[model samples]
Target: MANHKSAMKRNRQNVVRRERNRSNRSRLKTLYRRIDEAIVANSPEQARQALQNAVPMIAKAVNQGVLHRNTAARKISRLTRRVNAFAQNS
Candidate 1:
């Protein structure tokens, strides 16, 4: 219910951006969960593989502004350490 034309256009643009950002964020969470599941499964090989897949997705999320660079880097670092530890233990 935007009375002004510009307001209506802005509303449409916001809807489109919201959908795109939501999907991107959802994908990031799903990827993160996959890595977590692999870690919890107690299979180092699977965990390492999942981390490999998740890292790029996380980086892309950062690049897209869905996540901050440090946040993504921290996630990657922690996951890498966990995966490395799992590999060493296994």
Candidate 2:
């Protein structure tokens, strides 16, 4: 219940941003799952491709303020490491 006009406008903006962020997060999760599945299935090429696709999206999420820069970096680092390890092992 935003009584003030400005508050109401801000609330509306918040709702839009919340939904946008939610979708972005869901997409990221899907990408992560794809990578994880590829890893578990021992498909190096598929895992690498999924990691490649996810990195830029993660960065974009950081740029869009949906994720912190450090958080994005950490995620990218972990995914890359896992993919690299799987590649080396296979």
Candidate 3:
């Protein structure tokens, strides 16, 4: 148990921070999923749009210390390549 008022306050702050981080991570993951789905569906237009929107979101998460920059770059790279191929084919 938190023995003092300051410790109790710290506990509350930690809880709030954890929830916020979870939400932010969840949002990033959801966008990533959407982009992947569009790519697999071979919809060039949708994939491009999703990549346009997701790029900054992924970068922002990395900037916020939620994701590593290399990880974000790898995801962006693969998604872009997939969408570009779709565009070329269609």
Candidate 4:
């Protein structure tokens, strides 16, 4: 219901941004799940590799404004901790 031209343009932009953010978030969740699965499988090497891949993806998400820097840092921290713990155990 955006009547003004500028408002219509803004609405269009919002739709695009929403989709982009959703895709990024979905990708992040997938990456998190992969790391979790690797950890549960008790493969430290695989978990480590997944974490290595995830960290940069997470940073990119933060850079793209899909995720906050603190949130990204927190996720990276927890994932790294889990991977490190797995390494210590195995």
Candidate 5:
């Protein structure tokens, strides 16, 4: 319960931000899954494209403060490695 007017406003802002962050996270998950599915299907081109699309969105998440810089870097690194390995093997 936010009794103060400013506190109430802050709470409202938090709710909005929370929903936005959740949506961003959900989108990230979907992007990740797309890459994984492409890899599993052994479609190197699709996997590469998915990685290309995902990298920018991941960076955007970091820029938006939805994800930490290090976390974003780790995710990009892992996904890149997976895609590269899959491409090389295929």
Candidate 6:
């Protein structure tokens, strides 16, 4: 329902960006779950590997502006802490 051509274009761009952001968020959640499950299963090696994969994906999300830098940093910090604790205990 955009009257102006530019507005219509902007709407289209928003739709595309929305889908991309949703996909990125979904992937992030999946990675987080994988890490959590690894930790719960008491597999330090698997958890560490998942953490390795997750950190870069999270940093990429921050760089892409899908996630705020602090939010991403906090997520990375918590995941790292969990993995480290699991490693130490195991």
Work out candidate 3's RMSD over C-alphas: 1.7
> Which one wins by lDDT: 2 or 3?
2
Global CA lDDT of candidate 3, please?
0.88
Report the C-alpha lDDT of model 3 over 1-90, residue by residue, as the tens digit: 898999999999989989988999999889989888987887888989998999999889898878898998998898788778888998
Tens digits of per-residue lDDT, candidate 2, 1-90, equal: 999999999999999999999999999999999999999998999999999999999999999999999999999999999899999999
Clashing pairs in 6: none
Q: Model 5 over residues 7-60: C-alpha lDDT tens digits? A: 999999999999999999999999999999999998999999999999999999
TM-scores, all models, native as reference: 0.89, 0.97, 0.82, 0.97, 0.99, 0.97
TM-score of 5: 0.99
42 Cα displacement, candidate 6 (Å): 1.1
Give me the candidate number with maximum TM-score: 5
lDDT-sorted candidate list, best first: 5, 6, 2, 4, 3, 1
Where in model 2 is the C-alpha error above 4 Å?
Answer: none
Q: In candidate 1, what are the lDDT values of residues 1-90, reduced to their tens digit? A: 999999999999999988988999999888878878887888888888888889999999888888899999999999899889888987
Q: Please, what is the whole-model Cα lDDT of each candidate in the order they appear? A: 0.88, 0.97, 0.88, 0.95, 0.98, 0.97
Worst 10 residues of 2 by lDDT: 77-86
Evaluated against the true structure, the overall lDDT of model 6 is 0.97
Q: Is candidate 2 or candidate 5 better by TM-score?
A: 5
Best by lDDT: 5
lDDT score of residue 36 within candidate 3: 80
